[model samples]
Target: MRRSRCLLPAVGLLLITTACQGGSSEPPRATTPGPATGTARMAADSALRWSPAVVWSGDLNSCRQGEAAATRDCLTKAMQAGGASADAVTAAGQLSSAGELAYVTAWHEQDGIGVATVAYPFRANTNEGTRLIDAGGKRIDVDTVQLDDTLRADPGVQALLNAHPQATPFAPARAAGGTPLEGGGVRLVYRTPLRECHACADVGQLQIGYDFDATRHFVGQHVVPTPAP
Candidate 1:
């Protein structure tokens, strides 16, 4: 069984509460929860200033309407290119399936920009991987992943895990409210099995997520040269 990590105290304020619109709410949208010491705590404190929110279309039923159709088309092409089409389409369908496909939007607090990450039912799969998509359903990027060496022991990831006994690397929260938050929002954290070292068999475990700030401008995805390990 995958060993569990301690969780940090759920801090900050919950501005809104509704059934988790996406698939899982285990990982908050900002940073991971775990133990932290001196400088690590300071770093996390600074990062929390950015308010983050996950956005998706409010009306899924009208997906074929407006920019929804184009978004679907772009995802279809992405699937044809060898990315996970099945999962991609399913995610798209979730918006319309629920009778609402509100154009999902996310905020990048640091840059003060809002970028649409996914519609509702945001799905993340090892087989599917990450891809670049446009508001109009254009194919812009493929098989993207982010890795960080400092995250292995970062306080943000550590403190949360330490506080909650149920927290684990690959496990979901046993309780609904036992999750971590930064400042005013939560961070969506996850792990991907990729090599982080040349000689070591370590996978590129990630703890990154999306944040949406309406004022921030969307810069194109930063192309990380490393491939999924």
Candidate 2:
């Protein structure tokens, strides 16, 4: 084996050894930070708001069975903190699968539909700024209406809310002759899960009306029994 001698410099009794016969070992190759540098990756995923997971903790109480505005503020603030968007709390939506954790996840109500959160303005407000989106590319925002109907605890009526839960509120209500107005009547058409599948498919719709009085308070549910064939 052939050997090369490295030239050494000494200071006091210490020696600095430059062991290889090369001109600076390749200049350290200018490094460009990759996209996954821990901090950068974390910053990038902020839109999802996944954790401290604790940033996602707090009052996830049901908005059902309460004064509309108070219910809206309490639940929405908690849910938003818990990484839930307006849409995530709407229309059969749950914080965890099958309502697995927090307020809605830990409980159920009598004569209530377990569903995604849907909000409608109990009254009018000027919250027209766009701050969020839905599963679709279409843009929507969190407003009083979207906050109030947030039934974690959600369910909304058309033409009835100061604003509607649907992206297209002005579109005609799917229910025939049901009022979508505040203190007005509401009709909901829904299908019960035929089996115990949280993330499956089912078919069928049974509808009933929600009656409200002139004071805009929930009165009672009105059901027209299905006729046998």
Candidate 3:
């Protein structure tokens, strides 16, 4: 997925809230396959079906007004407008840098597909004024590196993959919460196949956490199971 350029300015901002809680060294509970009859069977299949478009790409400037709460409200509305269930749409987390709001919603009709959305408000004052006039009034261009750029290039991601070669890979790290560790990081979750149940629709999720600093220095790593839906 292409990262939104509008959110780059908020890369330095720390997440104020996380969507997933209960961080631990333990893995998340495995999803129990529902009864293979009637509506339950249909629901399971729907959840696994991928949506052609499940992301929220609307303007988030209103989120800047009330901070996290405002962002959640905006997300709730967007999800609903996008045909999401009211109960399914929830506030997952927020970023302190740009007050970015993260949300997680699920749709069973599409085979139980889980949708995670991260919305960031634009900051005009951030990373502005490339050329500033000194006392001598000389034009000088300033070079700045965005925090998001640094985190993406951080080697910690590769290290995590190296340590766990068996992990199932998912694209575009998710923004989550509930970790006790400090620093910024990407959230990668992999699905493990169910044992002895090749036909089962439900599976387990392994969440891999990699933390980094502003300069993209590696902080630490953690592995846990994603909370059961």
Q: Worst lDDT window (10 residues) for model 2?
A: 7-16
TM agreement with the true structure for every prediction: 0.22, 0.22, 0.21
How well does model 2 score by local distance difference test? 0.28
User: What is the lDDT, from 0 to 100, of the residue 83 in candidate 1?
Assistant: 36
Candidate 1 has an lDDT of: 0.31
lDDT of 3: 0.31
Model 2: per-residue lDDT, tens digit, 57-97? Answer: 23434444456423535555557766754444431122222
Over 73-100, each residue of candidate 1 has an lDDT whose tens digit, in order, gives 5434433453343333344443333343
Tell me, what's the RMSD of every candidate?
22.5, 29.1, 24.2
The sequence of per-residue lDDT tens digits that candidate 3 reaches over residues 191-225 is 22211133433222223343333333333433332
lDDT of 1 at 17: 14
TM-score of predicted structure 3: 0.21
